[model samples]
Target: MDIVLQQMHYCLTDDASNWLVIAISALLVVLWYERKRIKEAIKQDKTH
Candidate 1:
């Protein structure tokens, strides 16, 4: 498992690392938006 992790670490060059960070940030943003939207929907449903 350690060897696999080391190989993956070496495979990501500088550009790949930047893209990975961007992709993770975008994913987190989308998840946050979805969670907020769902909470609002549930609140509205409870009111109705």
Candidate 2:
């Protein structure tokens, strides 16, 4: 029973880490997209 509890704890922790990584990755992607858009707007302003 003790071993089973330990195994369950480990599994839950692993899943939590996976979710955290995915959330961070999604945030990074959004930041990158926004950065690119801002750069393009700056370039357009410079042209005018």
Q: Highest lDDT: which candidate?
A: 2
Judged by TM-score, which candidate is best? 2
How far does residue 25 in candidate 1 sit from its true spot (Å)?
A: 0.2
Q: What is the TM-score of each candidate against the true structure?
A: 0.75, 0.87
Candidate 1: Cα lDDT at 35:
100
- Give the whole-model CA lDDT for all candidates, comma-separated: 0.93, 1.00
In model 2, the clashing pairs are none
Candidate 1 per-residue lDDT, tens place, 1-48, comes to: 999988887876766989999999999999999999999999999999
lDDT of 1 at 48: 100
lDDT of 2 by residue, 1-48 (tens): 999999999999999999999999999999999999999999999999
